[model samples]
Target: MLINIMGFLVSYVFCLIITPLISKLALKLNAVDIPDHRKVHVKPMPRLGGLGVYLAFIIGLIVIGFPIMSNIQVILGATLIVILGILDDIYILKPYQKLIIQFVAALVVVYGHVSVDFLYLPFIGTVDLSVSIIPITVLWIIGITNSINLIDGLDGLASGISFIIVFVFVILAIINQQDTILMLSFVLLGSILGFLYHNFFPARIFLGDSGSLFLGFMVSVISLMGLYKTVTVSSLFLPVIILGLPLMDTFLAIFRRLKKHQSVMAPDKEHLHHQLIKFGLSHRKAVLLMYMLSATFGIVAIIFSKAILWGTLLFSLLVIFISHYFYNYNFNKIIHFLNRKYNKT
Candidate 1:
């Protein structure tokens, strides 16, 4: 355990020390996200921040001496995402093209047998979802990828969320006594923290599509392994509630798009960060608040996992209610009022 932790830390420091240099190179290459009316930031910031994270992650894994797997599906899936994202960063691929790439990556994970095979329903017994697990797992992977991608609008947003999730996964893995996942989480956590050095506030570089998709895929795969690796799904709620921020963001985005009759993949400025900014929060403050929200859910998940079913149920509802109260900052009301006034003509 200690050795695994050490390997992760060594790679983490390696990543941290090199992150600024990566940002500098990104800037020099003009791989920056330029400002637009819909964008929160007002400057040109270099992107493809995922490259450093991916490089550091792979280096950490190799250093940890687990490069080869029985099937190597996770490695291949993540690599595909990185390549697809890198290409999109350079050439700005069409939405369809990007979706196709994402689907392909999910397919690798699904067919590679790294998917969630069943839901270990608490008390209700094991729910065999094998026959339909493929489609469900694909959607889960693809949805999570896009969720993280869209949530990357704010500096430090996606990185911070990834940090929160991986941290929780590490803890869960330890409790479950899943040595492989526990070690994997350490390396992942370390690598992500290394990226945060450059990805944090007053960001030097954006993660672009590559980093977000890579992160989303990793979180999905790792969580599945943590909870579904065995014959039971006794603690699936932990990951779901723990990932409240991204899941809620994804849920809201889909509903908002559907309501507007827009394509689910339609780009917009109505993300969680954008709403917070509209409510007069600074970028730093908004991101920090989100971090706090993420931390709260993470901590609650840990506590909930140790509680009884009824107790966990109550705790989950309380978290949701609190989230609802705080998240409703009335941005939609403002938009509606403005639309009404303008449409009076």
Candidate 2:
């Protein structure tokens, strides 16, 4: 416990100290984000800020004496992701190019024996994936990697939501008594918090593709390690709830694009944060709202862990209610009308 605390503190301090240097390095390398129509920022900002997070997290693990062999595959995979992200930040790789690199990284993680092997269904018990685990694991990793990248629209948004998600995992790891995961979670949490200080609204730096991709990769891997390995049916939904906001946003984006006969991979300004801004919220307010929503999902995930089947049902209802409220569809209005009528009677 003390060691984990030390790891967290060391990671926090390291990231805080290194972020400014990384920002300057990004400027020197010309790895900066120049705003345009689809972006929210008005000026060019240095990227590659993920360098601080990556270095700080690695150093934190070293201080904790994190077992290398046990997590060697994940480390190797994350390294590939960071490298790909750095290159993408500098060169602005084509979508296909990024996809190929993401697949390779996923393969590294899967082959490292970190792939999902089975799932516990509600009635069918544990269903082994057999040969399917390979593809499924790769898809999961790539999907989540892109999900985080897709939601990196607002300053401090992706990193802030990720902080909440990682913190939830840290609690879950403690509950499950998974020491390695706890240490990793704390280190990651610290790393993001440190980076968030600079990455917030009126930002000094951005995570670019490097930081977003690296974070997405690590989050996916940690979810697998800490949540997916559990043998309960409710455990299957835990990661989904914990990461609900980004994953939902990603899926909605794809659906919206597809409905308009547009390519799903094409970027647009219609993301959730964009919609919030269009609805009159400031950038900072929008980002904070996202944090609250992400934290809400995190709470549901924790409840799911403890409440099992009932918790899953409760989470489902909450999702429905929240979706209706946000969309301002007729369901909520109808409910209100019906309640008023019942009161009058």
Candidate 3:
């Protein structure tokens, strides 16, 4: 454990110290994201910032891995995410193309044998899944990857929220006697902290697709592995609930887009965080608020880990309520105005 902590600290500092120069190079190369009328930021910022983060995470894992969690699956799964995300970052791959790559990566994680064992009935006991966990796991992996990707619209938001989530998982891993998750927690913690140095408001860089997809996949895979032995079917819902903020936000964004007869994959600045930003908050403030919400849901999930089924439903409902209330209160007019003014664009 001590060794793992040391590894994390080293890797974290290396990535943190190194990201600024790397970002400068990306800027020189014109690998920058120019903020548009819809984007939250008001300047041109270099992306591909995940390069440093991915390198730092791998280095930390390679140097000091926990007994269980830091296996070849982490290596392979992370590699795929980084590779696919880099492709998207550079060339803007089509949705279908990225989906295929993500599916293949999801399969690799599945082969790692991190699976949902059984569905827990409310009054009844656990029912082992007869069908394949393939579809379920794939959807989870892809969904989470996109959730984090979209939330990256705000500075430090994705990485900070992820850091908190990983921190909670680290604590949970310790309590559950699962040392494997420690290595992952260590690397993720280190990478996010390092990345945050550049990602904070008045940002120097954006994580681009590379970092978002990479961390998202890691979070989903690690969380599943941690709970595989403990959760039943109803308990399975906890993962979704634990990630309620991102998942719910993604779902509603897609729902809103579909209702407007727009492409679900279209890039827009109306994500949950962005909506909050449009409602008179600064970029940093909105990100911080979401970070608080993310941490709140995370803590709630940990507090109710034992009441798997009930916890899942209740938390999910809570997420829906908050999102609906916020959207209705803060965003109905904005969406209508945007639709009238910019939907054609």
Off by over 4 Å in 2: 314-318, 325-345
Report the number of the highest-TM-score candidate: 2
* Pairs clashing within candidate 1: 120-233
User: How do the residues 1-345 of candidate 3 rate in per-residue lDDT, one tens digit apiece?
Assistant: 797688779779988988988787777766778778778777787888887898888788667744435367657877988988877777778999988989988888788877655666666777776485888778878888888887888889888888988888887788787777777788779988988988888778889888899989888888777865664543655566578788978998999899999999988877888777666666666787788788888887676675556665686687679868875784657545544554356
Model 3: residues >4 Å from true position, as ranges? 65-70, 232-234, 308-345
What are the runs in model 1 whose C-alpha is more than 4 Å off? 24-29, 230-234, 317-345
Q: For residues 221-241, write the lDDT of model 2, one tens digit per residue.
A: 999887888898677788888
Per-residue CA lDDT of candidate 1, range 107-148, in tens?
Answer: 998877877777756668678887888888888788777878
The true-structure Cα RMSD of candidate 3 reads 5.7
Each prediction's TM-score versus the true structure:
0.89, 0.93, 0.87
Full-model lDDT, candidate 1: 0.80
Question: Ten residues in a row with the worst lDDT in model 3?
Answer: 334-343
Worst 10 residues of 1 by lDDT: 334-343
